[model samples]
Structure formats: structure tokens, C-alpha cells
Target: MQIRDLPYADPGVADARSGPRFLLWLGRNQLGGQLKALAWGLLHFCGVAGLPLGVGRAVQAVVDRSGSALALAGALIILCGVAITLGDTMLHRTAVTNWITAAARVQQLLARKAAELGAALTRRVAAGEVVAVSTGDVEKIGWFVEALSRFAAAAITVVLVCVGLVLYVPELGVVVAVGVPVLALAVLPLLPRATRRADVQREKAGRATELASDTVAGLRVLRGIGGEELFLGRYRQASQEVRRAAVRSARMWALISAVQVLLPGLLLITVVWYGAGLAQDGRIEVGELVTVFSAVTLLMYPLRHFEEIAMAYSFSRPSAKRAARVLALRRTTEPSGVEYGRPSGDLYDPATGVLAPSGRFTAVVCGDPDAAGLLAERLGGHPAADPDGAASVLLGGVPLDELALDEARAAVLVQDKDPVLLSGTLQELLDVPSSGKVSAEDALKAAQCGDVLDALAQASVDTDGDGDGDPMRTRITERGRSLSGGQRQRLALARSLVTDPEVLVLDEPTSAVDSHTEARIAAGVKELRAGRTTVVFASSPLLLDRADRVVFVHDGDVAAVGVHRELLHGNAEYRAVVTRETEEEQLDGITAIGELAVLEEIEESA
Candidate 1:
């Protein structure tokens, strides 16, 4: 976990049972760093505890007219300084290491979960919550982790100081030994209520953050509909609620701090007051009383840690819980090692009775958009779920999920209706790992991205003359928001084309484009993917007409299958679904046209 050490080959597993248990797990994982911090903390606290003894002994020696009191005190002071300096420096080093290592570990775990679950992770958790846990929550967790050892060291110092006082001067010692523990433990009962208040505050804050994120993500749409003020008012109300919760939480914490300060002050007064009575009775020396007073005052510093540790734990517990929720997710279609799915065969969906041959274009037409999407997801091997007696899609005869994950993914790619183009340079976005076969230029051409390239080129101002007029180097804004609807869709289609999978499933890939451009894109895709398996989920006549096989889905099942023109002539249901027209209505329109033409000829003859 040190800065100089190499990266981890394995980031290790996490325990996500509960907040406290996860905290304990983090501590255990970073035990070496924790021990380093603890050792340094011990040295530092011991150094501070030794200071009063040196001062008290020097005072007593001075009172007795000793020859070398100053010399002994000077030596002890120097030794304490060295110990304190060494301990403080190393303590900082190790504590920060623990904090950073813990945070990095959590981030890695989150990244691993994200990679495993892909886009499905966000469906199961709030986007804002995921953002919070990975950023703010991780730091709070690390803060608690680093604080634990320091608090332990402080507690031990308090105990040691009290025991020394009791052994040296019993009369005043008994007072401190009893008073310090009470001061530390008195605030415990208030912690629960305070922690609850803190939790409420966190919830309110999370809601506000989520609102802000959503409002920002849809700012363009909000402005188009003139709903800025409405969203603003909603967010304002959420912000105010957070403020109220925060204030409530602060009040509880304030009460705890007041107790912490008040109780310690009372203890100090008791020690001084009682030690004076002992001096009056000649039970202890003045110098010993001075020592007793200094030691009790010193306890106040470490006692502050008690409050800090409480606050840190309160803040980090909820954070850990949120993080645990995200880390607990598992992919539904786990990869299989022993069984490999069929490499080259028709992709068959048992639910829809649709089979895409190995080297042909297939189009699916469904009246229900939602059902089409679910079927598309299933065809891509990322099904929503598997209920009892449900059949899985198979490549050849083997189940899709039975294949290794990489193999299944390599076999098929489903470009959703609304695909996302990540923020980056155009080149980086197209540089997918599995895209060695299809060149970016070729894919872009097939996707009819000529205007998209021009738009990107116009937006980019290349500093070096050598980089001029090349669209590949154009930088895209986050989520491609800077591009128009059609331009974004074209770019997404181009990006997906470059993947060069064995089977490409596109759901309405050209729905956002103009009819002319969509017609060209349909033709280009047919030419580019001539010998590969390509299934398009679309009802557009231009796209459907290009398919070698068109399967019309009715009521969540396959109703008809044929070439687009053949299906139009042969299957009335398919015609109605694709063209939004029925047989009798179409006949009536043709007869009405004939009657209008006949009346025009009669008027000409008259």
C-alpha cells in the first residue's frame, strides 16, 4: 500500500455485510499500515505523558537546593522532544498511507463492480448514490480507519497517566482515576441520537445532490421546455431541507461537545481543589501537587479525540453502508469456464421464435417498443432475468449464458436505440478493443456519418497544421451533448459498427435520421455487412426492406416472417404492423382513388 510499492495484481475481496463489519474488514486488510500508525501514536502519547514528571522532579530538586536539578530537567526535556518529533512525523506518514490505501482499495472495488455489472449497475442503484459512495463516502471511510489507531493510543495514554497519578499520590490520584473515565464515558449515551440526526442529514444531502445531478444532465431539455424555474424551485426546496437536517444534526453534536468541555473542566477543578486540601494537611508535597495538576490538565488533550472519533464514526457508518450496497451486486449471466457456446450458427430466441442465420440480414418488427427492447436485450445474451421454465437464447445449440462472458460478448453486440458516446476524442471513442477487423473510416461510411465528421471537424481547431481537417482528432463533449440528435445517433452507429462482432444487433439504429439519410445508411449497412449476421430491430420500411429476412413480432411473439415486400403481399398482420394499415382500409383507399379519376374523366367528356 506504500507509494513506492508496485500496483496490486489482485485488489483482494471485500466484506459487505454491514457498515461496522465493512469498517472492520478495511482495518484488517490494511493491518500493516494500521500497526505502523499505532506504533508511532504510542511513542508520541508516551512522550507527552512523561513531560510533567520531569517538571515536577525539577521543582522538588530546586526546593531541596539540589546541585543539578536544571541539568536533569534539560536532559529529560531533550529526550521528550526527540521522541515527540520522531513519533509525530512517522505517525503522519503511516496514517496518511492508511487513509490513501483504504480509499484506493474501495475505489478499486467499485471499479471492479462496475466492470462486472456494466450498465446494469446503475439500474440497481441510484446514479447519485454511486457517485457519492465512490467519492465522498470513500474518504469518510478512510478517515475513520486512520482515526481508529490514534484514538486507541490516546485511550491507552489516559489510562497510563491515571495509574501513575494513583501510584505516586493516592489522595489526588483517586480523584483523577475516577474523574477521567466518567468524562470519557458520559457522552456515550448521547451518541445514538446524534448519529441518527447525522444519518437524516446525510439522506437529505444525498437527495439534494441527486436532484442537482439530474437537473444538470437534462439542462438542455429543461431550457427547451422552459422548465428551468420549476426545476430550480424543486432543487431549492431540497437544499433547504438539507439545511434543516444539518442544523438539527449540528445541535445534537453541539450538546455533546458542551458536555465534553464542561465535564473535563469540572475534573480539572476537582483535582486542583482536592490537591490543595492534601497540601494543607501535609499529606503531599507542593511539587507533587503541581505534578498531579499538570497531569490531569494534560488528559484534556487526548480526551478531545474521544469526541473526534465519535464524530468520524457517525459520518462514516452510513457511507460504508451505501458503498456496501453497490459492492454487493453480481452479474446475472455469470461466465462459464467449462462450457463454450456455439461459435458459428444461427442465433435463436425461443421466446420470439426468431432465428438469425450466420451470414444474412434480419429485421424484427414489433408494435410494442418495450417488448422489442426486452427481446433485443435477450438476443444480446444480457437478459433481464430467467424465470422458471423459461428458455435461454442459444448460439447453435448451446445456451448463450453458458459460454464464457468474453466469448458471448464477442459473438454478438446489441446497439440500443439510444446508445451513449462517451466523452473523448473521436479516435479514442472508436478505438474499441474488439474492432481490429473494421476500420473507422469504413464503419463511419456505412453509418452515413459524413455530416457528423464535418460537424466535428468544424468544431475542432487543431493547433498543429499537421493535425488539420482530420475528424478523427475531434474532441467530443461529455455524452456527445454538443452534437445534434441525428449527429449523435450517427456517431453512435459508427462506433458500434467498428466493433466488428460476429453478429450485430441494432435497435432502430437510424430512427433519428432523415428519410433520405436513413435510406442511404440502410443501403450502406447492407453492403458493408454483406456476409455477416446483422439483426435490426426496426419497423421503418427503408431498414426492413434491406433485410433478407423480416420477422414481425405481434403480442410479444413472432407472428410472421418473410422478405419485407413478400411479407407485405402475403401477411396482412405484418402489413398492418409495419405500415400501420389494414387490408380493407388499404382497398378502400385504392377504390376511392379510382372513383375520383373516373369523375374527372366524365367532366372532361362533358
Candidate 2:
């Protein structure tokens, strides 16, 4: 395919059986492109090999003092030059196109795999390895793919040139033929060592990249804990190891390069030396000797491709293996080819015996924050930390794993306690694949963040003189770090509200906001999601009171199920987990609740 028409529609399913199989699969998919490149490469190398023959013919013509023969030989040389120019140009163009297209295809596959695995990808594979596969590994794989066809053409040209030399002057041709393979295969012995060094360098580099990624991701936390220097020192040591490994790899490759040059030089010397004896013995003409020497010299050029192909394969092999390993990871809730459409029943976790009734607001109170987080993820069909022990979440009497990935994601949306906001425009952030029932403006209002819109618009106006004061146009920094914690939390809540899924599971979504805003947000959510199934895993009284039903999960199972006030009065354990109030203070809760309401009203009015 052409470069402009790149990024194949499917990229097809990858063969993740092994690294070599994956590499072969990639090659098979691009056979058409490789053939085109190979054809052009053959023309180029043949044109180059034909040049020495043209020169030898012209020299013979000059010695004969024949004007017409000399003129013909000159024209032949010009024709060879034209062929070389045309063939070389097209060959390079096709080869580069092949390289770019192969890289694009691999990248598309990686992207598809990443989308399939989501956050689970990092848990299954190292983030740095994934990064390396998409970056350095992709280029190496493409390089090998592009180099293969050219190497094939070069090898063919070498064989043809050797046969031609043997036919023209069998005496020198025998030595040249024997010596050429020796030159090509001479570097084979050092390749294992070179490849091992390269692998070490690649491993070191991946570690360094992973360390840097982790450090950057937790930079704010690192600074808060005064551990920046510790991480920095660790990163520095990793970088030094990478540098040392790279140097060792480079040295081995340099040695191979030296051998490539030296062996070819020795072959050229031998061909010239042997041909000279033949010339002096009158067994070969002066012109024939020149032709043999020139042909052997040209043969060295194509033979270099052997070493290049070896180097390319060595580097790309590990990269392909790493990529294969990542792509091979399957989610625990992955589809089983069952057709499940539009889930419409209670969301139940059989493992925890917790049921979120259909079309009702349910709040789950878990004392352990980590357990609550795991429950939220499981509710959305994502496996918890201990996936093997956790049972599949069921919706509408169907296990989530039976549904397609798209269907499962659409049926349930989970907002983790620590939701991340990617860097983009405000519009882009809210532009999720959502049910059209809820509008962005309405969702923002329900999230109780109208002030966030105003702040965004004002920020836009300040940044750009010609701003139309559109909040949607405002660009958010990475992770929304430029905004306050409350603002980021509210915006994320607003985004989730926009989705308006069949079932929404929120884990302490308002933990960053104040009690006043949290109360308003709870009311807004209750009003907006009146008829939908929403599960909020939280302990706040405001949120729990708003729920149609409250489930108190003790240890790892459901302990009690009731309304917030009923649980507070009847279950002392539930009251302690929800409000952390002593028995004496509980008697005065009515007066405290009245005071809180009065303060909320005053805050609202102000």
C-alpha cells in the first residue's frame, strides 16, 4: 500500500504466540509492499553490477582503436548510469514508504491492545516496556521489515555477479566466489555476543524509562514527601547503567563493522593479486583483469546488507517479543462471544453478596478505603487486585464477562476516588461517548460546578485577547494540576454525569470538595439521576441519606441493608463506620443535624 493510504483499517489480529511468529506475521501482512520494494532494489543493484562490465568493454574498445566500438561502449555506460539513477531513486522511495507504513501498522495494533486492556495493561506489563515497544521497538521492527527486501535484492545481485565473473574469468572467479561468502559469514561468530550486549542495553533502557515515568507521574507527591533527591539519585544511577550498556553494545557493533570492512578489503586484494598473475601469464587480457577487479569491488557493497540484516533482526527480535507479551494479555472480564444487549437488572457482586437494585440510588459503606475501591472497579467489570479470587460482576442476570467490551463499558461507568483528567480543552474532556439524554451544561450544573465554567472562561479571556469567553475553549493542563483539587474533582464528576450510563459506580467522588459543596453535589446527583441505577461507595451522611438504600459492607461481605437513618438508629457498627459518633453524641445528633442544615442554608444564601 502507498504511504498516504497507510494505517490499515484493521491492522488485523496479531500473532502473539511468540516473538518470531509476530515478526513473521507482520512481514506476511506487508508482502505486497515488500515485493514492490524488492523489484526496485533488484533493478538498482543490477544496474550497479552492470557498470563494471560497461567500463571493461570501453577499455577493450579503446585498445583496439575502433571508433564505432568506442562510441557504442560510451552509450552503454550512459545507459547503465541512467538505469542506476532511476532504479536507486525508486528503490529508496519504496523502501522508506515501506518502513513508515510498517511502523504505523504496528503502532495501530499497540493502540488497539492498549484500549482493550485499559489500566490493566500496566498491571500486566511494565509501562516502560509498553513505551519502548511503541517508540524504539516500532522503529526497529520497521527498519528490519524495510531492510529485508533490500537485503534479498542485494543477495540476489551478489550471486548473479559472482556467476557472471566465473563465466568471464573462471581463474579469478573461483577465488572471488569462495572469498565473498567467507566475508559475509565472517561476522556471524561475533553476532551472538553483539546481540547479547544489545539485549542488555535495551533492558537497561526500559528500566530507566520506567523509573523516569514513575518519577514524573508522582513528582508532586515526591516533592511533598521530600523524596525528590532520592528518586533523582536512583534515576541517575539507572541512566548511568543504560549508558554503560549502550557503550558495550556499540563497541561490539563497531568491531563487527571493522570486520565487515577488513574482510572485504582482503577479498579485493586477493582478486586483484590473483588476476594480475593471470594477466602476466597471458591467460587473461588486461581488460578482463580490470573487469574482475571492479566486479569484486562492487560485490563488497551488496555484501554489507548481510551484516545490516543480522543487526536489524537482533534488535527487533526482543522488541517484537515484548510487544507480543503485552498484546497477549487478556482482561478477566473480556467477552466470551455471547450476545448481551442493554443490561436492565440489579448490579450484583456475587463475591460480596451486595446488590444495587435496578433504577435506584444505592450507597455502599465500606470502612476500608482499599476494599471500597476494589468494589467500585469490580462493579464496572474490572477485575480487582486479586482477580482470581474475585468473582465476575453480574448485570441483568448476565455475567459482565459474557458481554462485549463495548457493551460492558456502556452498561456500567465507574469513577474512581482518584480520577485523572487528561490534558485537553474543556470541550474535549466532556466529549465522552455518552448517552444523549444528559447535556454537558446540565451535567455541569448537576455536578454543582457552574463556577468552574466561569473560571475556565475567565482563564481563556486572560490568555487570549480575542477570546469569545467560551469555557469549552479553555485548555486544561495535564491532570488538571493548574486547577484546585475541588475544581478538578467537580469537573471529573461532571464528566461522569454526562455519560449517564445504565449504572454508575462512584468511589468517594467528592472527597476533595468541602462539606457544603459535597451536600449540594449529593442533592444535584440525586435529582439528575432520579430513575437511574447509581451506586456511590461513600461514608458521608449527606450522600448516604440521599441514597434509596444503604448497604453496610463489613469485612468483605454485606453486613446490613437499609436506609441511612434506619441503619444509623439500628446498627451501631454501621453508625460508627458512617459517622464515627459515640453513643452519647448519637442522642444529640438531631440538634447537630439541625445546626448543619442551618449553616448550609446560610452558606447557600451568602
The local distance difference test score of model 2 is 0.87
Q: Which TM-score value belongs to model 1?
A: 0.90
Q: What lDDT score goes with residue 148 in model 2?
A: 92
Q: Which candidate leads the pack in TM-score?
A: 2
TM-score of 2: 0.94
Model 2 lDDT per residue over 1-606, tens place: 898786688899999999889989988988998898889888889988988887887888887787887788789788888888988999999899988988998999999988776666777787877888899899999999999999999999999998988898899888888888898889999999999999998888888988988888789999999999999999999999999999999999999999999988988888788888888999988778888888888887888899899999989888888888887877765577967668779999998999999999999999899889877878888762434667688898998877888888899998988889999999999999988999999999989888899999999999999999999989999999889999999999999999999999999989988877887898899899989999999998878877899999999899999998788777778877776776776776763465346546744763
Distance from true position, residue 316, model 1, in Å?
A: 1.6
Q: Rate the local accuracy (lDDT) of all candidates.
A: 0.83, 0.87
* Candidate closest to the true structure, highest lDDT: 2
Which segments of candidate 1 are over 4 A away from where they belong? 3-8, 339-342, 385-389, 461-467, 570-573, 580-606
Candidates in order, TM-scores: namely: 0.90, 0.94
Tens digits of lDDT, candidate 1, 1-606: 795662555668889888888899999988888888888998988888777877777787788777597679768878888888999899899988888888888888998888665556666787878888888899999999999988988999999999999999898888889999999999999999999999998888878877888788789899999999999999999999999999999999999999988998898888788888888898998878888888877778888889999999999999999888888777565666765644767899887688998889999999888778777878888744333345778877778877776777788888889899899899999999664878999999998898889877876755455568678988888889899889899888888888888889998998888766887888888888888899999988778877899988898778888887777666667666766765686655543344335434543542
